[model samples]
Target: MSLRIVPVSFHEACSFVDEWHRHHRAPQGHKFSIGAANEADELVGVAIIGRPVARPLDDRLTLEVTRMATNGTPNACSLLYGAAWRAAKALGYRRLVTYLQAEESGVSLRAVQWKIVAHLPPRRGWSTGCRPRTARGTDNVARTRWEARIAT
Candidate 1:
């Protein structure tokens, strides 16, 4: 599929989520304020900016990049992320925040030249039948919060 990011409607975003979940089982009902379309005009990624979960600091919305994916292109994730960020800025969001799996591709970050404003300390929270969990807790929250606050 050729590469290009396009905005998708809520229904289309839900369909993308369904397809993503088919390959990777994640929570349903992901909310995305914007989406990405490829060169083929196919939806490949989605982004959403939500109201601050903890507080509504000075009318700023939290740009929560809930989900992002690419069919196969190396730079597709970046395209999606850039488009999403631009969209967020267009919508008057002052900050953007997202959580990504270390193992997953960091194409989006690289594409946007996203800096690591902060990082969370390693944590030890294990799941019921899963292997050891990744780090968690205060450090992570602090870093994420900081990034959200600083991202423009």
Candidate 2:
């Protein structure tokens, strides 16, 4: 089935992610968002791009695919990943990155040419004695960081 990549508002994308994503909830915010629509014009997926959650990677030159969710539509994710990278480059960003839970295969990302850059160890939920916070439910899970450089 043919798919179209279209601009999506942050709110709309967040709503889609919340409804369809399996591993995590919608992100706190995003720099921008994109959607994948089927030939019939139904939204099948969304990608939320934002500043890197890790403070070390939060420099102006980099952006992250904070969340991506789909209604099990084949190729929807691959399309979103490619579109997100292209949009980032056009907007003058040098690098685009995203993290995947350890259990997730990076096939979709690989199909779009993103590389696995690092494997991060698991962390306790973001809550600490000093700064208590409710867990978003993904703490203690290992993650793999993937990245693609914007071609000049």
Candidate 3:
């Protein structure tokens, strides 16, 4: 399978994600989006990179893979992960981070040399009396945080 990296508009990437993602819909926004295309020029996977959702992790030097979805193409996730990091590093980001559902195996991350940085326990939705928000279906599902850092 010849996979090549391609630039994708956020809206186009989100549309592919909506059609293929298992647990979540497309994220609200991204700094950039990358796509993996086969020899036929069909996009098979996408990675949405953006500022970290958690305030503490929103340091200027860090960016997060807000969402990644693929059409089950072999090696597509690993390719996207690697491409995203290279793009982020080229833009002067020191670190790239992402999260996986706890039940998911970190095969793609491991392939790209992303380290397990933290195991995040599930919480009630981010909603608070001070900032009301809708509870998402992922409310009770734990997640694992992973990181790929540029060598200093």
Each candidate's root-mean-square deviation in Å? Answer: 6.4, 1.4, 0.9
Candidate 2: C-alpha RMSD after superposition: 1.4
lDDT of 3 at 118: 99
- lDDT score, candidate 3, position 140: 83
Give the poorly placed runs of model 2, Cα more than 4 Å off.
Answer: none
TM-score leader: 3
Residue-pair clashes per candidate: 8, 0, 0
TM-score of 2: 0.95
What residue runs in model 3 are displaced by over 4 Å at the alpha carbon? none
lDDT of 3 by residue, 64-97 (tens): 9999999999999999999999999999999999
Q: TM-score of every model? A: 0.62, 0.95, 0.96
Model 3 clash pairs are none
- Judging by lDDT, tell me the better candidate of 2 and 3: 3
- lDDT for model 2, please: 0.94
List of clashing residue pairs for candidate 2: none
- The candidate with the higher TM-score, 2 or 3, is 3
Candidate order by TM-score, decreasing, is 3, 2, 1
